[model samples]
Target chain A: MPIARGYAATDASKPLTPFTFERRNPNPDDVVIDIKFAGICHSDIHTVRNEWKNAVYPIVPGHEIAGIVSAVGSDVTKFKVGDRVGVGCFVDSCIGCAERDLDREQYMPGLAGTYNDFEADRKTRTQGGYSDSIVVREGYVMSIPDNLPLDASAPLLCAGITLYSPLRHWNAGPGKKVAIVGMGGLGHMGVKLGAAMGADITVLSQSLSKKEDGLKLGAKEYYATNDPETFTKLAGTFDLIICTVSAEIDWNAYLGLLKVDGSFVVVGAPENPIPVHAFSIIPGRKSISGSMIGSIKETQEMLDFCGEHNIVSEIEKINIQQVNEAYERVLKSDVRYRFVIDIASLAA
Target chain B: MPIARGYAATDASKPLTPFTFERRNPNPDDVVIDIKFAGICHSDIHTVRNEWKNAVYPIVPGHEIAGIVSAVGSDVTKFKVGDRVGVGCFVDSCIGCAERDLDREQYMPGLAGTYNDFEADRKTRTQGGYSDSIVVREGYVMSIPDNLPLDASAPLLCAGITLYSPLRHWNAGPGKKVAIVGMGGLGHMGVKLGAAMGADITVLSQSLSKKEDGLKLGAKEYYATNDPETFTKLAGTFDLIICTVSAEIDWNAYLGLLKVDGSFVVVGAPENPIPVHAFSIIPGRKSISGSMIGSIKETQEMLDFCGEHNIVSEIEKINIQQVNEAYERVLKSDVRYRFVIDIASLAA
Candidate 1:
């Protein structure tokens, strides 16, 4: 067993602090990763605070992971000691299920979360990417493209794939119009990815504050949703509207923005139930759907796509010691887009 | 102008009474139909009583119409005198739009409802098929198959096409497991259409009171939604669930019955907004969608399909004088399936 140093949430009300734990001894199919960077996602904050009411005590919370392979088992053939790799929201799934066999393991019944969950044995607890190092099944690890830097690429493991899967599933490409509902971490990635896919992209943010960044990042238009005219001007405009904000808003008004037979997809998990009128979708033959993170295979494809398009999250790098402050800023919507933690600070 | 005799709703609180109106003179592209049967739909009750708040006084509310062509304009090519015919929810749409050009006129703007709405000129009040005769453009009329009787085939114009459109749009066929919620007029049609399309069909009704009827109407299984065990047993069981009940129920519970990537479509209109938890659809990548009645082309396809399969609504025929009583029974769900008004009673 190898000693792993990381920040752990020991209590729901307290800040994360340094803790040391033992990593599992490598299995024949496992690869050991020396974590280089970990992005701070909103879900990490929720798990640490027990807001979802399912967190395990002393949970190590980080899923957007980018790192270098420190070691590999004898049977592992996909990576060498120096290969760049990443781990996303899940670490393992039921091996023989149809979803797993089709490379769509994210939706499998027996999926094991990277953290706050038990492994296949149901006894061994699983930790996540907040650590200095991690041991993952070779099948769950994705190879990072060489052109993308580790720090900026971390969020792609989660946010990038969240937007990519829906875009591809709904056939967003040339001649299709896509609208991203927020300008935060997940939504910014949607703009870049949708634009790279050749679709005309728009950002529907709360105000005109992020209009410049949105345009620079690939959105062709930016509108202030707070303005009443925005709704009227964009009525029946988009082929797809990807809602990335968890905050409650008028979902029916947004549904009105979609073209006939268009879809409204939700990536963010809102706390309250969404109140949608049956007439909202019925008149246009529209749909309101949901998407989770992508599978292990799709994540790889997303990373490859990002590499080809030179797309990465606009991030602010922070040390492990500043994580609590970063969380507060995240709550206030103060981060530029994302916050990535440099793992080298774990030693300090 | 030709004098048309029909029952009309003069006030919101009063019972319908006999009324005489004038029909537009035939144009070069017109067909004059002598209505034989008009099916009683819940929408008719809503409109006449002003439940939807958009009723036009003296409105003759019937869209599920079956008739015979008494005369055809010089330019009519599809039908001759004495040819069987039918008319559905709409009479005209904006010409040259993409939706109309694609034969999907139901979703096009400027759609002229068959009743309680104005004609293309926006001045002529378009009365529906409860009358003895109706004058319509040839493009808006459909030719009924010779084998199917006019009375039983009446509801196919509305109830039949409502379910058929979603079944085809969602690819419900062999290997697909479908659930039709509510076993009323709309849902019963769904069971027949889905089974006829080769999909495994189930009925999820409030109680098992209609279980035998559901099973006899092409459903492979029936379950009482009031039973807690039904939800647990059928979790993730359906590829598609078409909700036809306008009453409020737990939508999240039904969303749980869908398999990964499955859809729950709505053709019924609930007065209040449905409250759905985001988690219900997020985990399985499921969707909640809506479908209206079929387009002119698809409605014709549905009728032709029903004809080939020997399918027709199980209807209780009533004379025109009993329509007011039929409306009361319909509100109580007392009819076996549907109520078809015999137009000959108007002359008697």
Candidate 2:
């Protein structure tokens, strides 16, 4: 067994504190990674604070993981020592399960989350990556392409794949007008990815504060949702609108912005239900859908696509000790984009 | 001008009464039809009683029409005297407009409702097929196939296309498992049409009250949505769900029954917005969409398909005088399927 040191919330009310735990001995298909950078996701805060109310204490919450493969089990064929890789929201799912058989492991009922979830054995709680090292099955680990900095690529594991899956599923490409709602980590990645995918991109933010940054990130237009005219002027304009705002928005108004046969996809989830009228979708044959993070295969493809397009999350690097302060900024939406924790600081 | 006798609602508070109106003289591109039968849609009841709140007084509400072409204008090359024909929700849209040019006239802002709405001239209040006759542009009139009876085909004009458009738009066909919610007029059409399209049909009614009828209408299975186990057993089972009930439902529970990438399509408009959690659509990438009645082109296609398959509405025939009684029954969902008025009663 390898000893790993990380930070964890002992209870919902407390900040994450340094803790040492034993990682499982590598299975035949496992890859042991020396975590270089771990991206802090909004979900991490939600889980640690038990805002979603399902969090387990003593939880090490980080799923946006990027690292170098330090060792591989005897039967690990996909990765070699020193290979750059990453892991997303989950580390394992029962391979022969129905959802996995259909290549939809992310939705599998038996999926083991990277943190606060029991592994396939149902006895051991699988911990996550806010750590110095993580042991993952070869299949769950994704290769980070060269030239993309490890810190910037970390968020791609979560935010990148979250946006990429829907854009591809809905066929957001050339001649497609896509609007990304909110200018946070997920929405910013949506702009870069949607623009890279040849879509005419627009950023729909709460205000014009992020207008300059959004446009520079490949948005052709930026509109403030607080301004009523934004809704009026852009009515029935977009072929696809990816709502990255976790707050409950006026869903019907956004549905109105979709053209005939367009889709409004939600990636960010609010606690309560969003109310929508049949009139909004019926008149134009519009649809409202939601997507979670991509499957391992699709996640790899997203990373490769990023490699080709030079896409990486705009990240604020933070020392491991700065995580508590970073969480505060994330809650206020004050971060430039994403915050990636330097895992080496844990070693020191 | 031609004198047209019909039943009309004098106000929202009273029963429909015998009233007289004038039919427009034929325009150069018009087809004047001597009305034979008119289907009483739920919308007619909604309009007459001000349930939808947009009704203009003395409204003669009927749109699902079946009749004979009594006259044709000089440029009406499509129809001649005594030709069997039908007209649906609208009589005309702004011709040569972008949407009308594409044959999607129903979505056009200038679409003229068959009753209570001003004609394209913006001055004349358009009457409907409940009258003895109607004069409509030739392009908007559909030719009823020789094999289909005019009375039974009346509901096919409104109810048929309403289901067919969404069923087709969502690609309901062979290998697709389609669930038709609500077994009323619109839903029965969905059952017939979805079955004819080679889909594995299921009817999800409020209870097994219509189980025999549903199976007879070609549904392979019938489930009572009132049964909790039905939701559990059929979880993620359907590829398409067409909700024809105008009443608000537990939208999230229904959304849970869809398979990955499936759609819950609403053809019926409810008075209020439905609350849906982001969890319903996100994990499975499921969608909630809505479809109105088809385009003129698709309506023709639906009719052609119906004709080819010998499909028509299961109707209860009523004289125009009984329409008020029919309205009461419609509100109670007491009709076998649909009611088609004998327009000849108006002539009497």
My TM-score estimates for the predictions, one after another, are: 0.99, 0.98
Q: For model 1, what fraction of the real interface contacts is kept?
A: 0.91
Model 2 chain B: ten consecutive residues of lowest lDDT:
B100-109
Worst 10 residues of 2 chain A by lDDT: A96-105
What is the C-alpha lDDT profile of model 2 across A221-272, one tens digit per residue?
A: 9999999999999997999999999886888989989988899999999999
Q: Write the per-residue lDDT of candidate 1 for residues A35-146, one digit (tens) a residue.
A: 9999999999999899999988999999999999999999999999999999999988898888887777788889989999887777788998888999999999999999
Compute the lDDT of residue A23 as modeled in candidate 2: 91
Provide a comma-separated list of chain B TM-scores, one per candidate. 0.99, 0.98
Q: List the residue pairs that clash in candidate 2.
A: none
Clashes by residue pair, model 1? none
Q: Give the chain A TM-score for each candidate.
A: 0.99, 0.98
Candidate 2 lDDT score relative to the true structure: 0.92
Looking at model 2, give its docking quality level.
Answer: high
TM-score leader: 1
Question: Can you give the lDDT of residue A245 in candidate 1?
Answer: 97
What local lDDT score does residue B87 receive in model 1, on the 0 to 100 scale?
Answer: 97
